[model samples]
Target: MHQALLVPEVLLEIFAYLSIISYTQTTSTQKLLAALARTCKIFHEPAMYLLWTEIHGLEPLLGCVTRLHPLIYHSGTWWDDSDEPWTKGVEPLSAHEAHQFLRHSSRIRTLNIKSEHPHLLSVIPAEACVFPRLKSLSLSTTYLNLFLPHMLHRCHLLSVDEGLQSFVTRCIALEHLCIYTPHDVHGTANELISDRIHWCTRVVTLSCPILD
Candidate 1:
């Protein structure tokens, strides 16, 4: 190992650059970071941190579990080359497997969940404060009931359904909320506007596409 690699700042800068480069070369960057993580003990923490700090979906975190099987390509759904493969499992997750999942889950600050997989939520261990440091979350209404327990600072909702008020009320720490509804110009839900007014006083920002 080089002396420069021994410096915390230097290692962070290197990993940070790789994180940025991941924007255009995601797979390559991930492979490089994974290699760095396995290179040595000192490189492990920062390398893993850079790899897991921000994620687009739940697949990466769930991938840590050995028992869960990926169901994306086999489900008849088109698997996008750019995204992580979706997974589903019915086997019981062992304590060690759950620990591995949580180890990476704790590092995530931003999460964007697209499709709903009830099995995804089912695999999580009970009474666990998953994503303890999570700050921003983007998820659809199908995921609405799953992440309400987190102390999120920002939330973006897509494909919103009924019960908007009840959902917003539970996010006590939410500072910003963006709701995207499928309703058109003349079909905006009255309950949505009322709920926004009700929550506007507490939350710093309440954004809705229809209102704009």
Candidate 2:
């Protein structure tokens, strides 16, 4: 009798379970599994459901991942400041790559990157709207702009300088928009965002930004 051969698929499942334990929150581990699943199809269902169903990050409130699933997402602001010694020449995850990760998420209907790091932000390809289910967007610090023309149910304006003004001027069907900016900037751009709020209508709620 021949010995049974262990399938690579089974091994991948084992690896995924092991990798997930190291994650404290649900997001990173799920993301890792999603990445693994991309290597093959057998892992798709398990990986997508396990990881894509929900995502949590260090923030104050729920974010983009919430749009995909209505699960309780803890928002605690956490950052790793330790500088790992240079190994070979590996680079940090790129903005493009981060956005691509969402494409594979298969369940990310919302995206929240509203951290203080502006460089962590990047544009999502118009064609790469993997989350056709996407209905909401939240920025890390409102330092970015939205060029994608798709209609959103709710759009949270990141606390930015001039990006919000630039954004308000574009959204035509935007029903809900929250902006976090300086009082002066808001006062100045309020006219602009309000001007375009509707061809002839104004927004429902406007949160006044305080000067720091």
lDDT of each: 0.68, 0.46
Give TM-scores for every candidate, taking all chains together and pairing residue i with residue i: 0.71, 0.44
- Steric collisions counted per model: 0, 12
Query: In terms of TM-score, which candidate is strongest?
Result: 1
Candidate 2 structure quality by residue, lDDT tens digits, 107-196: 554666533432233344323434444456666433334322345455666554444444454444556667665556656566655554
Residue 97 in candidate 1, Cα distance off native in Å: 4.8
> Model 2: runs farther than 4 Å from truth?
1-43, 46-50, 53-102, 116-132, 140-149, 160-162, 165-173, 183-187, 199-212
Model 1: residues >4 Å from true position, as ranges? 1-4, 7-9, 19-27, 69-100, 123-128, 148-151, 161-170, 184-189, 200-202
